[model samples]
Target: MAVHRALAGICLLGLLLCLSSSPAARAASKPDYLILTLMWPGSYCASTQLTEKCCKPTNGEPAADFLVQALETYDSTTGKPVTGCSRSCDFKILPLVNMLDDLYTYYANLTCPSNSGMPHWKDVWCTYGTCSSLNQSLYFDRALRLREKVKPLVNLGSSGIIPHATKSYSLEDINDALVPRIGFSFTVVCTRNYILWPFFYDDYLSQIRVCVSSDGRSIIGCPNGRESNCGDTVKFPPVSYPVSSTVIELPSGDEMAL
Candidate 1:
């Protein structure tokens, strides 16, 4: 009887170890929510300094709209980014070739030392993409599709929040315009206008962060809640480009890669 109990204990321990070490277990350990970060081109360019290079794509200037910045995975419990899942990045461009046109149009690299936006895409894939349950192709495809579904420009414009050089809109109005249309709350991010230094320091609408389910299909309320540093009123500036490339060090952070 004692021998039988010992053998049973060993068997149960082995079974537990096998299940815990499986691929499914590894995937389950990852975060189950994603944040789709969308950046407004007008605000991005307007916040730039003369030293900071903000160029239009060689192909042409992308539409005056909100561009896909990143699709980041975040911990639902702690509301922090999940990264460095795989030690080996193993990023390849071949799988993303078909989507290059849409990528360039919607997610182009505006900063100086620009290539085909591959470096930026590669960085994102290696960082956040590897952390998700998606391959390189599926990750980029998902972000693009989400951007299409959340037609931010159309949603905001319908609410009479189109970009203007001199016009400013209240933060409340901006939230009201987006939350109902998106079916979920989002974080309104803003950047300080460096162009108008000490004279008139104003915040410009920079990025909108919408949360999505792990499957990357349905929009979900951000676990982090709607957080913003925007003032009472924020400007929505017009998009413009420098004829010559102005050079400055690129900003760091997963969201500022664009």
Candidate 2:
């Protein structure tokens, strides 16, 4: 009986060690932060050639620029992304009703055209959001609030990289446009969809992701391994709003004001 008990204890220790070494375990331990990955609607439309898969314009003039696409979490030290940490999303009480409209507007499920914003929000929550120290309301609400803070289009336009045509922009020019205004530097990366995106262009602006601290307030840099892979000369495409005819104006809608 003594020998058997010792064997069982050893087996338990081994099992614990094995589980601790996993990606999920390692990801859970380190300092974690929320990552906001914004996608250009124009680039998505142009690259995939799927104009129908875009979020439809509502309320006022279409937002034809960088739109909030994804919210994920990763380790702050290692820059390793950790997702799907648990099956449960902390969606105990449903989010604020007012946030639902803001969600559909900013956090639209462009990839999943048939569905609403819940899948995108829920998936993000179930994966990275759940892993965070933040609760469901805090997690989702923070995204809406963060959106209010970061507006790259307005800054970039002011820097003379206006949304008109695909221009080859230096890395310095892009960063110069953002850092001064937003007060935080961003990682400018490009799509790996070489076949989908034309070779006539260099890497196009895929995502301008910013890392927010664990408290979900301050912005931090992306993790070490997750730095930008974009070349110096990147194609900054024109912001395209899938429109019937045309309207040229900054996004001026009451929905945006809120």
TM-score leader: 1
* TM-score of each model, in listed order: 0.78, 0.74
Clashes by residue pair, model 1 = none
- The deviation in Å at residue 248 for candidate 1 is 26
The runs of at least 3 residues in candidate 2 whose Cα sits more than 4 Å from the true structure, single-residue gaps closed, are: 1-28, 48-62, 90-93, 192-201, 221-226, 241-258
lDDT of each: 0.79, 0.65
* Top-scoring candidate (lDDT): 1
Which tens-of-lDDT digit does each residue in 192-247 have in candidate 2?
A: 43553456435777778877877678777554535578877777777555545433
Candidate 2 overall lDDT versus native: 0.65
Q: What is the Cα-based TM-score of model 1? A: 0.78
How far residue 100's Cα lies from its native spot in candidate 1, in Å, is 1.4
